[model samples]
Target: MECQVKANPQVKEVVWIHDGRPIHSFMATGNVEDSEKGVDSDLNQYQSVLNQRYRYDHHYQQQQGPNHHGSTIIMTNQSLVIQKVHRSHRGRYQCVALNDQVVPGCKANQKHQYGVSKNEQIRIRCEVDAEPTDDLTFRWTLNTSGTETAIEWPSFTIVNKTISIATYRPESSLDYGTLACSAQNKIGIQERPCVYSVVPAGRPDGVRGCAITNHSMNTLLIECLPGDDGGLRQHFNLEVYYGPNESRSSMKVLSEASAQSKSFSSSSSSSIVFDNQGVSAIQHHQQLRLHSNHSSSQPNFLVSSLTPGTTYTLNVYAANAKGRSQTVSLSAMTLASPEKHVARARDSETKLTFFFASEQEASNKSLYIRFLPY
Candidate 1:
């Protein structure tokens, strides 16, 4: 935030006051004093507050104006620029000029707060009356730790009079709090604080390694490993698609054929198709009920009432308050019907080999019959 007091031939000194307290004082003779952040010199008795930082600059360059040369020259800058604004900047502000009897009006800007993502850059501004006095100066402060502290390098940088910007990165500091800027001179100070809050970054990457753990003639147990949750609590969704055992696209036709499975019901045997990519190719939807004791890295889900000797495509998703992650897929085939088993006896030894519908059916199972005579 920036505040300025224009200096006239008659004005001698300008003081900025905030909350009825004098913050800084500027003089037409090119002298500046900051009671809170200024460096102690032989001419000033105030101790330098190193933790409280404020900056002062004088604009001496000639600019086009109403003078005979079409330029307005100044002896002092009489301007205050806050490099960064925080929550502590809120308060009543008034600028007072001494000797010249011209008092600069001071009013605090509206108190406002902003929400930013991690590593986002934010800027807060303060504006003060800059009537003819040339003795006004600006100061900036931050109150992230409950106490007002001087904002410094690496986090804050000066933009211009009335504007200061700061960057907050999660890897660095965790403080996302208040910023303040004050306009002042020897007479008084006007200050206002702005609030700022930082939210965590976006949702995490998708889950990994979705595969089947166990399955029976009518049931299956699927497991997967989920990635980060974007710093939020997460849950897993297990989607199952069952059909006349057709292609991935055919599952949609199967779901359309069975309207009773419109929503997921524990008792429903029909599949429910979802619409995220091909993940909707499921015959049923089930939220994986996980115990709190279980780690989020690995989640397990159980599917029930599947047809004997049938194939199912499962898509799992990890979601949080922010959003859902990408889908991880698992294909499973149920065991053959008990009636399909045929027992054969050879020389008092028996061999068992289960038959499957196709090569794709064989790949979906964790166990294949071994040809060993027992």
Candidate 2:
């Protein structure tokens, strides 16, 4: 490969070296006729190499103009091209112009934006290019809020010559900010910066202790304990199904039912049961209610306008910054009104027998004996 290096009159001699060993050298004495004689450098050490334009100038008219009287001269294209480049040649190389005049060059890939999470490990690589590459050293820094902080050894590990890896734990005060890698030599230092952002969280854990509490003919109360909030604030949603059963078809009907009669009670602990018999039965009414705004401290919900004597399957789900959790379901049936049972008992002949029904006697055998005036 051909490598062209610029040259100035002050550059009396130019030497091509790889890995601190000389490959070729060109000595300039300011004369074009002596250019071929000045190439006294060795090339047979590794491979065949050549040099061009290394001589001293005696007269100005012979080179540029008849009247140009300058002691020093400037040479344009000074190149060193290799034939059939080999993998072994891929290493630090330098084109030394005048022994003590050091020149530095910087190289690095373009910085890109990366998405990361808390406590994640990341690797960054940067490169430094300079004449006499061994003269340079590299280090990294972090920029936070316009403040620059140098990276230390144990906190970040160096990989090979140009790469480094570090683990970022946001909990630590030192881990947050943009990253920059700097290359420094005797001449100067150059740097490259990278950008990154944190990714969103995942779904939270499920809620616990989800169960139905006290209820009247038209309202029901439910309570639950929220689990892990996925590192963010959480809210709740309650879905009620009151169709034939837990089948998908019944759930579809429940999904279509309007919640115009549904509402949340201001009381922390309350019940929900429907006063309208048509809406209370499984065959006639299906309703789905949602309650979004509630305090995490008090997870008790008072659902209103529910049907009496009808069973409902209620599901409570919690949501946070990430997503919603799996639903917790509970079933409860509202109690039938006592006034109808009292009316039926008055219509019966034996007052003692009329006081109790077969279904009621089977469920609750303990009778409260109360005497009424004759």
Candidate 3:
């Protein structure tokens, strides 16, 4: 029996299967002299059972010389020469050609965590990247309570030969666990499976590391580090509130000065109000809401039309389908605009000098003087 295979990239190996099992293998080392030595050990046992009556030969042919080719022609032949025909050899035979084999790498197309409610069906997509995409197969498994159960066909559908979507419904607490997907091709099965966690949806975690990144006379740029989404999509909200400075004297003066100004009310439950005696009636300035299907690692909010030299409190909250997270608070003050200054120079002097106060005494501020001849 002879089997021939022709492939690009050069065939790396040839395997002979009999009765749905591998009976012999040959490593196509590309060297004609080493063809006999490439026979794998798997053929030894089979040959012994046949009393060494079978002779195996691997033949490689190159139709044209290396330098004289329009296209290099390569072919491999695996022949099982039987000295005498026997009834035991009457079985199906096949030859498989293999180039470089690649193990499939699978990953969940959706978020790492999936939110599910009881009796709600969710379709999770798994994608695989591998070489030789033909004949690829996928396997899904559900692991719950230390027992892994294999999910058979009809539960999942394959699309475009590389993506598989598995339909799963969580009817009880036991159904909320981990779903893993693995893939295999003619080469081998994937070593690691793509995993996704299923859990009850809830509010997202509060934002962290809130800080005033940029501050001007009329605008404040606030940035915060995002947190987990609690197995759901999350958005961010920023609320700005202004009140008297933390100083007792400052609060008293501002309250009295602004007593005649229009008063504003806030519907936020977490609003902080300050009274006349420096007790923290904060007026809600404005609210900015950002909606995003995917949250970034660091989200920034720009609050404009702010009052200069006034201290304001900013609250950031993350909201999801379930609810909103706890408020993360940050206090920031916009820079005061510079006041006009007039300077007079002496008759004999060619330039006038001016001075400004530095907010922090320990700050390393510099002054530069450039004199141009008139």
Q: Which candidate is the best by TM-score?
A: 3
| Alpha-carbon lDDT, every model | 0.49, 0.48, 0.61
RMSDs, each prediction?
22.0, 23.8, 14.3
Give the Å error, residue 271, model 1. Answer: 17
Ranking by lDDT: 3, 1, 2
lDDT of 3 by residue, 1-374 (tens): 55665666466665655543454334322222233343456566544422321223334322212322122112345554432233443456555555554667764455667897889888988898866678999998887753566454358899998889888888887778888888888756777888878887778898887777788898888888889888887888876665444333433344463453344222353344333233443333444222212233346787888766666666678988888888765556676655311122233465567555756742667667875532
Which candidate achieves the best lDDT against the true structure? 3
lDDT of 3: 0.61
- lDDT at position 70, candidate 1: 20
Question: What is candidate 1's CA lDDT for residue 181?
Answer: 53
Give the number of colliding residue pairs in candidate 1: 53
| TM-score for each candidate, following the candidate numbering | 0.30, 0.30, 0.50
- lDDT-better candidate, 1 vs 3: 3
Give the residue spans of candidate 2 off by over 4 A.
Answer: 1-200, 246-298, 340-374
Lowest lDDT 10-residue stretch of candidate 1:
45-54
